[model samples]
Every structure is written in structure tokens, then in C-alpha cells.
Target chain A: MKFSTEDLIEGIRSGNKRLIAKAITLVESKKAEHRQQAEELLKEIMPFTGKSIRVGVTGVPGAGKSTFIENFGRLAIANGKKVAVLAIDPSSAINKGSILGDKTRMEELAREENAFIRPSPSSGFLGGVANTTFETMMICEAAGYDYILIETVGVGQSEVLVADITDIFLFLKIIGGGDELQGIKRGIMEMVDIIFINKVEESNLQKAKTTKLELKRALDFIPAKEKGWKVPVLLGSALYNEGLSDVYSTIDEFISLKKKTGSFEGVRVQQAEKRFEYWVQEYILSMMKKNNSVEEAYIQHKKNASAMVFNPSTEAKLFVEKFLSKGPD
Target chain B: MKFSTEDLIEGIRSGNKRLIAKAITLVESKKAEHRQQAEELLKEIMPFTGKSIRVGVTGVPGAGKSTFIENFGRLAIANGKKVAVLAIDPSSAINKGSILGDKTRMEELAREENAFIRPSPSSGFLGGVANTTFETMMICEAAGYDYILIETVGVGQSEVLVADITDIFLFLKIIGGGDELQGIKRGIMEMVDIIFINKVEESNLQKAKTTKLELKRALDFIPAKEKGWKVPVLLGSALYNEGLSDVYSTIDEFISLKKKTGSFEGVRVQQAEKRFEYWVQEYILSMMKKNNSVEEAYIQHKKNASAMVFNPSTEAKLFVEKFLSKGPD
Candidate 1:
């Protein structure tokens, strides 16, 4: 099952599922040889990427995120589009796996021939987890997936990270009874492009309507995340497959609007630049780890700082001056 | 007005207000010679710093932040403690100045001999602004200020930055007519060590009670920010000076709890470490800017990246390798 670099490129280009998954594994690997091959494969597949609509979905737990994605994926396939689903859980290591790791959680979407699902890469720092997810998205795109769905638990900073990598950010929430809207996370309200109120049915229809209006009022206090786009909140029952078409149409209208305004391309470009910056920061930190002089200086300064013998800022300045003059090995 | 370094140190140690202000101006300056002198002053003052209780206060506009600080400062001064108030507004440039710049904002407190007020520094990036504020706090501490109050607009990322440098983070909010708790910014709730429901008088007392109960329920969903502390929500009217004593006592209790648990010193050490890291990052970025090969390669890679000829991550790796091996000059 060990594919050569050329094999990965060819297999991925031909939409070979196994090879696509293998390529993702390669990219996620920390091994130096695997990383070299992964980089090579990523370069070869670059042109084939950026062909899909990347959507990020986030919500509190028990909000029916998996059901919504399953239904959404199926709907996309019904329209003759291939779909790929990926999860990003920074806490995935302790949680065993993300919601997507258990295929049965998304059984309907998992059985679809045009669908692909990958769990959160249960390891690494926040940036690394996000990088792997981004790489996985690219691999899915090269495999001809027309839609990419990225999921994140709305509890942490991952929501911001996911919003950075995707074109559309969809927030899903469910109101238990009353006054739960205040529980919506802080900065997330400003980042959401569209919102889905899941689990709306006969019993909670009135409650959902009230929640929607309340949410609109709350949204009024915040500025639009994007120009020429008013964030829309739609109610639905994902478990019953209710209101799936509305969700699809809303996404359609949003994508077409963003594309027409040229912000679609603009966002992708910004995302690329941000991605580049992150990689540069990672590279610099890694290099610092390997440089003995930098490490020694850092430890010495830290000790001095803790003992109150030197100001942290002054210590940092002195360390940097020494580091640059001697060069990092 | 031009005091030598030794004279400035003596003046500060003796608690001369003019010298303290001059020292702050020196640290805030970007001139090379001034920076060297500032560093020296900071190292010499190290033994005198870390004596004050640092408190950060943030609230939405018109939430009576200035009035609250005025009343709170008066309370501290009445208790035989000197207090210094500083503001941090990232949007200060366009907004003319932070709420504190006018002096009239806290006229009563400004007139008190025990109180010193400094407006937000009207320049630099976010980190630079925070660094200046931290240095100013140290200078105030060395001058025997018993309390340092840092104020942020509670709108931007400044709340997080302010939280990083202070020992206690207090969030002041007022509930309007109905359901205004939803207006609370997301992540701020998690960082708050104490919450003050400001403007709680006869008319809004009922409304404030509802908001308090609702906020407490919402807080239930979030884990404790610190191990031994339970975040408290208090009610008070800053303008009427009705609940100033309660706010002061709450802060006193929280600080004592933190000190008893040893987390007070632990937090300061962590803050020191974070400050050092930020300075290092700033130094590296500045070095990269001055390095010609790094800039040339950056532009070339940027061009290739925009043209879709090179993946940004790979480009970043290549650039770092070249920069480190050749040394940044």
C-alpha cells in the first residue's frame, strides 16, 4: 500500500479513493521522508485543487452537526456533485475521535459512492491540525470532490481557524427552550456567514421562530462579516431531512453572490497568504529548536526573567541580537 | 525636563509624578538612544516593580466605564492606596483618543493627589501598545502605586491583551430593556474573573436581576477559568456610586484567594514568559524585514504563490532554509 510519489499524484488525479486517503496520511505523517513525498505530491496536485466550494460548519455539541452534514452531502450528490467531509477537533486526542471518525455516525452519507469522509487528525498542535485539514481538503479536491465540508466544535479557537480556511462559514445551533441565544459564543457571531437552527419540528416550531427573530436582533448589533451579504438564519430538522432544499438553495445563493462580487477569489487569496504566514512561523520555530545557540540564549533569558534580574523584553532583545549575529545552524 | 538616567531613577524611587511621566515617555519612544536608556531604567527598576495589584476593566461603550473607574479609584484612594489608571484603545487613531485622553472623562479622580491617569498610546501595533502599557505599569509600581487599573474598550482583541498583563479581569456590563445579555461579547465571559452588572438602580434593578440570573446560567456551561476561583457576578451603579464598596471588596477577595493558592505569582510568571515570547517574535520579524535575501525570496515566492506555481507552505519552507543557512543580514 506504499505508493510512490508519482503514484500518489496519478492516483489522486484519477480520483482513486484509496490513494487519496493514502496521500492524506502521507501529508499528516511527521516522518521526514513522508513529508518530502507529501510536499512533492501537494505541488503536483496544486492546479487540480481550488475547484471545490469549501464550507466550514461549527456548532455546540448535540446540535445535530453530523446529521446536517450527512443530509447536505446527500443533497449535493443528488445534484451530481461529489462531496468530501472533514472534521477538525483540537480536543480529538482526548475525545478518542471526532464525530466523523465513526462512519456510522454519518452512515447515510458514508454509503454514498460520491461521498468521502475523514475524521479529525487526532494529534498535533492547533496549527498543525488545521494544516492537515487544509491538506486533506486539497487532496479531496484533486480527487474531483465538488464540495468540501469542514466541521469544528464551536467551543474553542478552532472556529476562528476553520473560518480562516473556508470560503463559507455556517453555524448550526439548537435552542432548548428559552433565552439560550445568550449562550452563543462571542466572536463567532461576527464570523458566521449563514446560520442553521437545527431540530426544528412540530413541537418546537414556535420556539424556533422566536429563536430566529431573537437571533436576527442580535445579529443587528454586529456588522456584516462580508460586504453585500446579510447573514441568513434558516430553521430545519436534519434528522427528518426537513428543509434540506432550503439549506442547499441558501448555500447556492451565498456562493453565487460571493462569486459575483469577486470576494470569493479575494478570500481565497487572503487565505493563501495567511497559510503562508503560518507555515513561515512554524518553520522559524522549528529552526529555533534545532539551533543550540538560540536554545541556550532562550533558557538563560528565561531564567533571568523568572529571577527578576532582567526585563523580559530586554532579555528577548539581547537574545535576538546574539542569534542573528552568529547565525542559526 | 531632560533628566539623566540616574536622576530619573532617583525621582521615580522618590515618587515624583513628573519624573514618572517622563520615564513613561522615554519608554514609549522609538528612538534608538531613548530605547537604550529605557532598557537601563527598566532593569534598574525591576526590584521595585511587581508590588501593585494589576486590574483590567472592560465594558461596552456607554456602559459607564469611566464613571466606574472614577468611583473605584476614589474608593482605593480612600483606603490609603495610590492608584494609576491607563486606557488601551486599538481604534484610538480614528477615534481621536481613548476615553481617558480627555482628562475630563475622570475629572474627579484626576484631581486626586493619589491618582495618576495616562491615556492610551496613540500608535504602534497591538503588541507594541500592550508592551508600552506593561512598562508603564512597572513604572507606576516602582513609584509606589498600590493599584494599577487598565481599561480597554471591550470591543476588539484588546480585552485579551489587557487580560494577559493584569492579575484580575473585571467585566462591567449593563442590561438594557430586555435580553441584552445576548450582546455580551463571546470569549470575554471565559476570561472574566469578576462580572459587575453596572447601572443597577431602582428602575433597572428588576431587569438587572434577570440578566444576572441568565448570565449565571450561561456561565454554567463554561468551565472555571481558574482552579480555586468561582467567577462572581455583582450588581452596582457606577454613576450613583452605590456599589463601589462591593466591587472593591470583590476584587480584594479574588486577589487574596489567588495569592493564597500561589496562582498569583504563577500567573505573573506565565505573563512574563508570554511577554518574552512576544518580544522574540517581534525581533525575528524585524530582523526578517531588514534582511535583503529574505525579502527578495519572499517577493519571488509571493509571486509564484499568486500565480499558482508554488504551494505556500513549500515556499515558506524553502525561504526559511535559505534565510537560516545564509544568515539574516
Candidate 2:
């Protein structure tokens, strides 16, 4: 964390794990000085970023997500590829529980010299986990981690947010009879590019196949995520390490298909454009929360709102106008 | 449309149909002069608004929603109650094809002197259908329409928006064997206050009963919307005009229960508060879109973003600062 910006950039480029972690910590910092430093650090290594394949893995709590990611990460390392895993921890925000770092769960991958696993950045700056995770990913990419796996808690808005930054979104579903019934809930089926039916080893093989068929039928009602690619449902056993090659192959197929259709770059371009909007909105909201004058105005505004003497648009405009008069500079 | 503000206010208080329609047209207009007038008009009607019991009705395209509303509205009118219908035409903003007015479908209600049915408002600023619908509802309430039925296309984001503004959300389910299966899909089942199994006239009676049982079991997993109320599934035949009094009784009971429990006023106050945030976000986005300098900056920013020369948050802040410098005055 104490390294100069130039040295940090050099360390990351040289694949120094300690420096990579420090750089990620710097980006995750909420302090203004750290942010300024992080910006400088990001600027120095900007060219080295965007070389990795970002994949988002999501499922409900007990859906074998950790086990699957562990095996998948180890498999990639065995193939002589450098891998990095970043998780967007939802517990701290939703339940105020302890951090759910997969360090213990992914024991083998944690020990793999060719792999790196980072816990979800602690809640910082309005608890903006997505932004922190994204910044951490850039640091990982600069550190020469080629395959970046982003794991999000499948509940709430985390999965949708993860899908925006990642290239392919893979949904891991446990082999259950109610697969079709639960898949379409929360509109999750419409967002996924691939479905992995995990825990399909031993006696569960037939049930998994039936679930695949049911899922395919259920998906018929929902539109495809991409134009040319049909979301293939593949069976897997993360515990027994079965049917993962097909998973990577499907991802490769998706990447090439998206590239061929030019949607790969197209989606990324849109994300870049969305980033501009997000920054302005987040900055405006945070500043309002911090400003005493705006806070006072909002209290008065709420009273007027309850009395039906004022409307939201006019009051919001006034709030912004007053904030502007404070002179942001 | 040409009436003075005092005249318009008096006309609406007297339930003058022509003046009420003109006031709604004013609210639906996007021009600056009209918007200024609309705000003033809304202020005058604010005391009279929030008098209606708002209900949102949604289903898939072929779900007999129009037919059900027709018979149900007639039933309400027969019971000496005033009814108003507002259909949110999704085609205008999304599909751009035919208008989905309930005029033809609800012939009986359309002919009733005690009933007032308005088609969806034409596109206005930012193509905000929900805003127009809310404004229109206020105008209708000023004219003393006590029972307000809002019809939304159930497929997309519209239903969720409708749910926020209404008192009770009613989901109409045709007596399909897969009622329970499809209802839980997309988390829509969890949001409804009541589910109506429509078209259970003769041959579909048995199937409807079975569907109701299955739905009740499936709903057991979903938490209740209110502390003391459970979502009841009922069978009805809209075409035959049978079992509709029970529907109104259930609604009346729900209103009395919610009023007694203080949640009726509670939800409305929360909605008023949310309106403030929504207005701020929408106004900010719209103003940025209209500013030519900001537009040019965005184009340049996108280029820099793709080249990794800049990130979204920093560029967005710079863009906002530039916009602020133009002087909002």
C-alpha cells in the first residue's frame, strides 16, 4: 500500500502478488487521498488492463457455486493459465454478517501458484461493491491474471450488476425437480448465457437430464441473451469433477460467436457509456448526503411533499441548483 | 383546454366531463408552457386526489383481462359505485403498433353514465407513461371517481411501476393448468394482493379449482404482503358476470382492513417519498440528454473510455462540472 504509483504499476506488470493485492486495496479505499492515488495508479496501468476474459458465476446459496468455481479455477491453472477470482460479497450489505471469502472453500485453488483469489472488497463508499469489484478486476488483469472469474451472490441485484461487467454470465443450478419453476423467477432465466446443472454425479444423473429438458422448455418462453447463441444446459459435478471441459468450450463458443456477430465489443461499448451516467449519479447522491444545506432542504422538502404542497421534480431541481451554488470546486 | 385556472378548478370540482378531459390533456402535454400550467392545475387538485381506491390489473396478452374488467366494472356500477379505467398502452412506447384502449372491450362500462374510461395518454416528455397515468388518476379522483382500475401490460417493467402507485395489485389468471407454474415465474406471484382465476364458467370449473389449490400451496412459500392478510385465490366467470360481488366484497374488506391497520396511509406516504428520488434521477438524465455540449463530451468520453484513456466516474464528474458551469439560470 505504500509503494509509489510507478513501482506499483511495475510490480503488477511483473506479476508480483503482494503488490497486486496492495494495488487492489488502494483502489478499494474510501479516503479521498487514496482515491486520487488509485486514479493515478489506474492511469499508469490502463494499457495493461482489458486483456483478461471476465466471466460471472452466480447461483443460489447452496447451488455448489463455490465448489464449481474452485474446480474450474484449478482446471484452468492446470492448463498453464493464470486465473483470478473476485467475489462481490452481499452478506455485509444485506445481513451485516461476516465476510464470505471462499479462501477455505477453494483450498486447492488458493494454494495454486498460477492462481489468485481475492475476497470481496469490504463495504466502502456507500457500499458500492460493484464499483470496487470492477476496480479490483482491473488490478488483477494488470497483474497478468488472464481468466477473471467474478462470483456474485445470486440473490438481489448483484447478479444483474455482475453481468454488465463480465463477458459471459454462467448460472449454476442444482439438479432439482423444480428447476423450471424456479429458473424464471426474478427474470434470471432471461439474463443468463449458459446454464450449468451442477451436482449431477452418481444417482442424480437422470434427474439432471430431466431438469435440462425442463429448463430448455422453460427457456423457450424467455428470449435468448444473444442473437446466435442458444443457452446450452450442461451437466456437471464439481465434487467429482465431471463435465467442466464442455463448460469452457461453451464459453469459447459464446466468445467467438459474439465476436463474429460484433456484439462482444458492442456490449462492452455500452457498458463504457453507462459508466459515465453511473459516476455522475453516484457523485451527486453522495455529495447531497454530505452537504448540510442540501440535507436541511431535503427535510423541509419531505414535509412539503407529505402535505402535498410540492412535487418531486421541482424540489429535486432546486436541491441540485442549491448544491451547484455551493460551488463543487 | 382554453379554460382559465379558476374555471378549470370549478369544473373539475363539479365533475364536468369535458373539463376533466381537458385538464388531463394539459398534464399529458410536454411543452414548457403546458407543463407550467399542468403543475398549477395539479396543485389545485392535490387536496381532492388520493380519494380513489387504485387497483392494478395485469396478465399475459390472451388472459381475458379486458373481458374481466368489463364485467367487473359493470358489476361495480350496478352496486352504485363510480368507476374509472386507465389503460397504460405499452405499444406506444415499446412496440409502436395498435392502441390498447378498453373502449371497445368494455362496452357496457363505456356506456354507463357513472363510468369514465380514458385511453392511454400519448407519448410526452421522456415517453413517461407512468407519470401521465398518475396525473390522469389525480384528475379522475378530482372528478369523484372512487374506484380506479389501472390496466398494464404484464410482460415487462410496467407492472412493477404500476404496483408502486396502486393500492392493491390484482393478477388475473385464466384457468390454465399451468397457472401455478407461470405465476411464480418472474416473481410476479409474490407481489400480487389477490389472484383471480377467470373464465371458470362450466367445463373449466374443475380445472380452476385444482389450479387454485396448487396456487395456494405454491404461495405458501411466498411471504405475505401485509401482517394480517393472506392473498386469496378466487374463481370467477367474467363473461357470465357471475361471482363478481365477492370480488368487490374482497376489495372492500381489503380496504377496510388496510385502513384499520394504518397500512393504507402508510403505503401512500412511502410512494410520495419515492416520487422525489425518481423525479431527480429522470430530470438529471433528461437534462444531460438535451445539452449539446454534454452530448459532444459524451461522444469524446466514449472514445477515451474504449481506449482506456479515461474511466466513467471521473469523466462523468468532469461532464457534470462542465454542465454546471453553463449556469442553470
Best by lDDT: 1
DockQ of each: 0.33, 0.27
lDDT by residue (B284-325, candidate 2, tens digit) is 555555667766765676567655576665565566567657
- CAPRI level of candidate 2: acceptable
Candidate 1 lDDT tens digits, A23-133:
989888766577678778888889889999999999888899999999989989999999999987767767665557775799988889999988887566322334478
Question: Which pairs of residues collide in candidate 2?
Answer: none
- On a 0 to 100 scale, what is the lDDT of residue B26 in model 2? 85
Residue A139 accuracy (lDDT) in model 2: 85
Give all candidate RMSDs, comma-separated. Answer: 4.7, 4.7
Q: Which one wins on DockQ?
A: 1
TM-score of the second chain for every model? 0.91, 0.90
Worst 10 residues of 2 chain A by lDDT: A94-103
- Each prediction's Cα lDDT score? 0.81, 0.74
The DockQ assigned to candidate 1 is 0.33
Q: Can you tell me the DockQ of model 2?
A: 0.27
